[model samples]
Target: MQVLPKGVRHIPGFLDRTRQEQLVEAIRLVVAEAPLFVPEMPKTGKPMSVRMTNCGSLGWVTDRDRGYRYQAQHPVTGHPWPAMPDVLLEIWNAVSASNKTPEACLVNFYSEEARMGLHQDRDERDLETAVVSISLGDSCLFRVGGNTRGGQTMSFRLESGDVVVLGGEGRLAFHGVDRIYPNTSTLLKHGGRVNLTLRRVNP
Candidate 1:
């Protein structure tokens, strides 16, 4: 009952090695209730080496004068964004063929010298729902492209409970994350790499 290949998916052990250690203890309680830093790239505030954080109910951020945006709190601790762990909304309503229940998750942390260039996530407010991603710990290099820029490119390695699904028009296609292979997954305990992106943010 694992899936991932409608254009790109691997689903290696699609969650259930005891729920993959309960999704790594629910992402370490959402990084201890939103507590990871290293953001400041807005208009040259300069300081992004991938270390951001978030939970549920909205929490994606950026600063280089705003390139990406999502907020409900926590722009440096306004205190409010952290609660999407009912096992990640039951794995986003069971892989969401179209049951969508994601109100923003965007918790990305990577560190074997972090890397996430080439981007494209169109400020989610409407893209026909579905951008569900959830690859935890090590094994990177997940590049995807289309919607015109050379029109075709692909890469994969995803691993660790891999579950990626883009929507309508490939949910605006164009993807990122192309690095980090160091110490490739010993099953988390501090080694870096966590990407939980569940979208649909309209407030």
Candidate 2:
């Protein structure tokens, strides 16, 4: 077992091939309805490298003007996000210690060149709830640091079907994808990585 920072648990190949394919198909349905849209950084309005969409009742969204917040509808389509798939809820129930079910599942589609800067997931009203992340498609180097920026950090490779749980003291840790390795996996049809982050938006 790889030793990660406190409260950070990395479960490699947590999902079998069959389950991974099922998740991919489920996300495909989600994208067909919600569609992925580019997210922008607050103030600067810098566009994020990856395209994003969401599932579940609440969806995470960001724009230069309003910043990061959870909304009931998509930014461009103005339609309510599709409901959270039952498979995701089962994963949360099996892993997340909290009794509350996730209200939002942020779907991030990262191309070969897409990379995310290290940041904390603090938009949620309750920080006590855990953040459950499921990795599918290509592999990427995931970087994780302590609660504060500039703190000690570590990098590890996350492949398809990997599951990571950020809970307890690690709930607010800073983490991000350094870069995506193209053709690393055959999960996604066209080749890319899909990251599904499940979180409790409200207290």
Candidate 3:
């Protein structure tokens, strides 16, 4: 078994098949209210491979002009983000190990060819709060490294229903998705992966 960094907890099969299906339905409602939009890299305006949206009080967004930041309204819809689902709140309460509630649930959908570069989630005001990531649908090669860029890294498969928590020393870890394994699972009707990241944006 590969050992993860300090404070980085990986729980395999955290959610059962039924729960995963329920969460997918909940996310469908969220996407209906706040459609998934393409996120762009700062300055270069390069589009990311994943399509994203969010729920909760604040949503994370990035663009060539504004860069990475949290906002209350969707960039495309210009409406307040939908409320965080109770199912997500229950999961956070169960595994977050924090007293405070999460204020943003960033939803990312990865196609078979989608890939994410190693990056840190540092735009939020509260760095101490842990980031909870829940995976559904297909599995993917998830990579993680130390806090510093260009450091040694490790890779592992994050299958559907797996959960990862980045807190304490590992909260600022550099992590990303290497690639998606096509037709890995049947959880999603279309055979893509959906990653839900729960975070506390403010202190």
Candidate 4:
């Protein structure tokens, strides 16, 4: 059996098909308000493979100028991010061990060819709170490593309705997506992947 790092909880099929559909619909409404925009790498300004948006009081955004940070307004639209969906809030309450509610839900849409580089979630002030991640649509190869760079790593397939929580020692672990499996799920009409990442930005 493969062993994940400490404090990393992988709950497979945490969301049922019905709940997944409902969450997708909620995200659609969020997209309608915030609209997905391609994120850029800090300094280099290279566009990331995934298109991203957010809901909740704060949204995670990165650009050539400001880098990764949470803000109240969309970078392009200049409007506050849509409120966090009830389903997402419920999920966070169910999985997250922290008492504080998540203040940001970063929504990332990944195409079949999209991939994410290994990185840590360290922008938020509340590092003690667990990061709740929900996977939808197609499955993907998820890679995770230790807190330090170039450490031992493990890769696993994450399918639709799967939930991953990173807290405790694993909160600062390096993780990313390797590749997305196309047509693996029929949840999204266009055949891609959607990742909802919930985080607490403040103490």
Each candidate's lDDT (Cα)? Answer: 0.76, 0.96, 0.96, 0.97
- As a whole number from 0 to 100, the lDDT of residue 187 in candidate 4 is 99
Query: For residues 1-203, what per-residue lDDT tens digits would candidate 4 score against the true structure?
Result: 89999988899999999999999999999999999999999999999999999999999999999899999999999999999999998999999977899999999999999999999999999999999999999999999989999899999999999999999999999999999999999999999999999999999
Model 4 superposed RMSD (Cα): 0.6
Output the better candidate (2/3) by lDDT: 3
- Segments of candidate 4 deviating more than 4 angstroms: none
Please give, for residues 10-100, the per-residue lDDT of candidate 2 as tens digits.
9999999999999999999999999999999999999999999999999999999999999999999999999999999999998999899
Assess every candidate by TM-score.
Answer: 0.30, 0.98, 0.99, 0.99
Which lDDT tens digits does candidate 1 get at residues 1-203?
A: 53332444445668756776788888788778778877876688888778878888888887777746888887777898878888888877876566657887877888888887766678877777767888887888887876555666677778677888776667767778888787888778878788888887772
Clashes of each: 9, 0, 0, 0
Question: Which stretches of model 1 miss by more than 4 angstroms?
Answer: 1-13, 16-44, 51-61, 67-91, 95-111, 115-133, 136-159, 162-181, 185-194
- For model 3, give the 10-residue run with minimal summed lDDT: 1-10
Q: Write the per-residue lDDT of candidate 3 for residues 1-203, one digit (tens) a residue.
A: 77898888999999999999999999999999999999999999999999999999999999999999999999999999999999999999999899999999999999999999999999999999999999999999999999999888999999999999999999999999999998999999999999999999999
State residue 53's C-alpha deviation in candidate 3, in Å. 0.3
The CA root-mean-square deviation of candidate 2, after full C-alpha superposition on the true structure, stands at: 1.1
